[model samples]
Target: MRVLTVNAGSSSLKLRLLGPNDEVERSTDAEPGVDLEEVLRAWPAPEAVGHRVVHGGTRFTEPIVIDTGVRKELEDLTALAPLHQPKSLAGLDAVTAQLPEVPAVACFDTAFHTTIPQAAATYAVPGEWRERYAIRRYGFHGLSHAWCSARVARFTGARRIVTAHLGAGASLAAVLDGRSVDTTMGFTPLEGLVMATRSGSVDPGLVLWLEEHEGLSPREVAETLEKRSGLAALAGKADMREVLAAAGRGDAGAVLALDVYVHRLAAGIASMAAAAGGIEALAFTGGVGEHTPEIRARAAERLAFLGLAVDPARNDTNEGEITAAGAAVRTLVVPAREDLEIARGTRAALR
Candidate 1:
């Protein structure tokens, strides 16, 4: 079966055409993005279409066939993941309008962390806020984490693994027996490790203080945190390449930015690894994890105490085997296959 996978972002749409064997025949990004109708109009429609829905909330713990009720629930979830859900449903509507008889599946980023223990997910708050408001953590990047974990199982036959999906939007997950035990992304994508623009893990009191003292509205605060912070706010640019170059040229802020980013990442990974008891293998995926050799090298260096060390030469050249021979913990760079995962998930749902 051929499946067309759509991941709709706030400003762009990522797409791929995948077959039953999980190979991408064609993949592309479109922007100023087009809707699903436009996408389908350009290519042959697949047996099914898989939509990447960012937040399923508590209602959905697995992929589900789209229906009117599901659509409404997804619409309601927009408030929870304002950066993603609107565009996702817009694409979903376009596809449903164009291919009414076709099966469409919603694959959620939150679903993979459904098994996260309450101790890890709960915030220190009243029961009313926790239960009625659904205010516990719901980690994102489920697709990438799932793909990398499965790849680790294939490569090492390891049941305990840590997958770092690093990119402009980054997260780490601890996988035990192929299930998510813990993840860095929490409550929202903004609550994880620092990203291109998103401020990860800031004190909630700071937000309330800003609103009370600075007279900033909730929307303004959200925009600042989600769109104006992180590497961009600290170092003048969010692109890692630029940050590294600036740091090499003696930009203190750039140097500090990189330090904070790596430290937070290492800390999160260490925490997740502890949750799963011990990590048998470590996998890196997504844009930064797969492409930025410097980031990977630095990360591995910090994690050497965990019995992982990278071969500097291999790490510099983007080789999948970054770990040195005889390393206690295997380290690999697994290019994320979210498209394939989406296709497989959607195919299964369609059946």
Candidate 2:
């Protein structure tokens, strides 16, 4: 079956055509001016279109055939993920407008972590907030976590693994028996380790303090935490490459940013390792994890107590296995494959 997988982001749209063999037939990026119709028309007629919906909330636990009720529920989730949901829904509409006869399925990024226990998913909020509002942890980065876990299983033939998907929006996952038992991102993608622009975790008192001292509203506080904090606030830039360059030039702010980012990352990974009882192997996937050798080296340095260390020469290059010969656990860098994952999910749903 030919499947068209759509991953619509806030500012970009990525679409890939996958055949029955699970290989990419064609892939392209569309900008604001690009015609969605022309893009879909260029690909061979797909049997189905699978969408990567960013937030499923509590309504969807698996891939579903889109209908009126499904569409409305998806729309309702837009408030949860304001940045990506609108674009995802628009991508779905665009695909349907072009290929009305083909089946369309919605696969969620939150579905993989649905099995996390209540203890890990809940917060220390009041009972009314916990039970009435569903105010609890709903981790993100599930798609990347799922893909890396499967890849680690295929590569090392191991059942227990820890996969860190570090990028602009970073998160770590603990996979036990090929299932996600715990993860770093929580509730609103802002309750774990620091990220490119999002403040991973902050004291609630800080929000009230800002509100009283600066006369800021709750929405302004949200924007600052989500858009203006993290690496950007720490080092004046969100890109790790720029941050490293500045640090190399002896910028104190940049240096501090790097230290905090790496330290927090290591702490989060250690927690995941503990959750798995002992990590069999560590897989790194995502933009930073796959490309930034310095970050990988630093993170592995912090994990040496666990018998994890990366070979200098191997890490300098972008090779997969960066672990030393005598290391207890393998350290690897695997590029993420979310499009193929979505297509596979859709194929299974069709079956």
Candidate 3:
């Protein structure tokens, strides 16, 4: 099946046409206001299209063929993923308008984590709030985590694995027997590891204190935490590469930011290992995970207690199976391939 995968981000739209064997036949990262229909017309027409929807919420647990009803349901989920859902809808509308005859599938980033057990997904909150709001951990980056976990399983034949997706946004997933048992992201993408711009896992009381004592409005607090915090707040830059460079130049803030980032990352990995009972394999994906060897090395050093070690040579190489010989846990790097995962999901749903 030739599948065209559509991934909509905050600032760009990614379109990839995959051949039957899952090779990328054509692809493009179109910025906002690009003529999507014209772009689609320029390529070999895809037999089917798959849209990467960010939040499936509690209802849509799997990929389904997009239709009038499904589109409405997705719109209803906008509140759950305010930053991403609308973009997804816009992408879907544009592509479907271009190829109305072609079948379209909605492959959700939240779908893969739907297998998370109730206990792990639930929050320790009031029953009324939990019931009324449907408040629970709905981990993001499922498409990346799903692909990485399966790739690790294929490489190491390990059923217990932890896959870290570390890019502008980051999260860790604990996959046991090919199912997501637990993950770092919860309820929203803002709940996990310190992102490029997001302050992850802050105390609820601090928000309340800022609102009450500091006289900051709820919107002001949210904007600061979501946009002005994290590495940007610490190092005055959001890109990890710049942060690394500054730290190397003896910048105190960048050094502390890197330390805090690695600390939270290692701690999250350890927690995921606990969730999966033990870690047989550890896989890293996303920009920082694949490109920044220093981040991986620092994380490995901190997680040495879990038998995680990376050969300096292989780590520098930044390729598969960077794990040292005889290590109890196998660690490797997998490039993020959410497009391929969406294609796979689309084929499966159509089948």
Candidate 4:
């Protein structure tokens, strides 16, 4: 079935019309202020519409048909993913408004990680708080991770894999036999490896201390952690490419930023490997993961203990299996394909 996938980001909306054979028949990236109706009118109406919803919370674990109840539930989840859920809802509204007759599915980023075991998903918090708030790890970037893991398994025939989805935002998933056993992201997208702007895995005590001693309001703390931290705070630039360039120029801050970034990434990969028992294949996807050979090489070097090493020439090629000869672990670079995953989920939901 032909499916039109809608992926809404903080600043842009990505629309991809996939043909029955999964070819990208047409695609467009609409920034804020673009007329959604006009954009939809320009393309052929799709038989189905699939939306990339950031948070499905504890309720929705798989792709489901978007209906009055589902829409309401999704809206209620806005607080869980305040930065992304509204944008997704807006995109859903726009597409359904343009083609109300087409079957629409809400494909969640959290769905794939729903299989994570309780030992990994549960937080070491008060039972009352945990039960009342449903606070647990609900991994993000799962659609990308799912696609990468599947590709890695097909390419290397590995049952245990670690898939890293690195971009403006980043996370790693430990997949065993096609199911997510553990992941870096937790509760929200801000809990994993250092991202473009988000501070990953900060101490709760530090946040409370700022509020108690520094007298910073909750809003201020949130804003700083979500928008003013990470590589941006470290190097004055959020983009990895720019940071790498600055580092190459002997910029101390950029060099330190890259070091910390890779450190956290490698450590997270090790943790994921532990969760999956061990890593047989390491797959990289997303913008930085696919294009930045330096980051991949650095991460591989750190993970050498796990027998993960990339061939210098293959890594430079920036795609496909880049595993070094005689290495026990295979390494691959897979382009992010959330649209295709969304399409697959849409077809399954409608079927």
Give one digit per residue, the lDDT tens place, for model 2 in 1-351: 999998887777788999999889999987777888888777788999999998898778778888889999999888777777888898888778888899999999888888877777778889987877667777788888898889889988877799989899999998898888889987778878888999888888999999999999989999999999999999999999999999999999999999999999999889999878888899888888888999988998999998899998988765477888899988888889998889888988888
Error of 2 at 192 (Å): 1.3
Residue 96 displacement in candidate 2 (angstroms)? 1.8
TM-score of each: 0.95, 0.96, 0.99, 0.98
In candidate 3, what are the lDDT values of residues 1-351, reduced to their tens digit?
999999988888899999999989999999977888788878998999999999999898889999999999999999888878999999999888889999999999999999999989999999998998889999999999999999999888999999999999999999999999999999988897998999999999999999999999988998898899999999999999999999999999999999999999999999999999999999999999999999988999999999999888898855688998778898898989999999999998999
| Predictions in order: lDDT | 0.86, 0.87, 0.93, 0.93
Looking at model 3, residue 182 earns an lDDT score of 98
| Cα distance off (Å), candidate 1, residue 143 | 0.7
Q: Please report, as a residue range, the 10-residue window in candidate 3 with the lowest summed lDDT.
A: 317-326
| Selected candidate, larger lDDT, 2 vs 4 | 4
In the range 257-340, model 1's lDDT, one tens digit per residue, is 999999998888888889999988999888888888888878878888888888877786543768887788888999887887
> Pairs clashing in candidate 3?
138-187
| CA displacement after TM-score superposition, residue 344 of candidate 3 (Å) | 0.6
**Candidate 2: residue 229 lDDT (0-100):** 94
Q: Please give the ranking of all candidate structures by lDDT, highest first, separated by commas.
A: 4, 3, 2, 1
Off by over 4 Å in 3: none
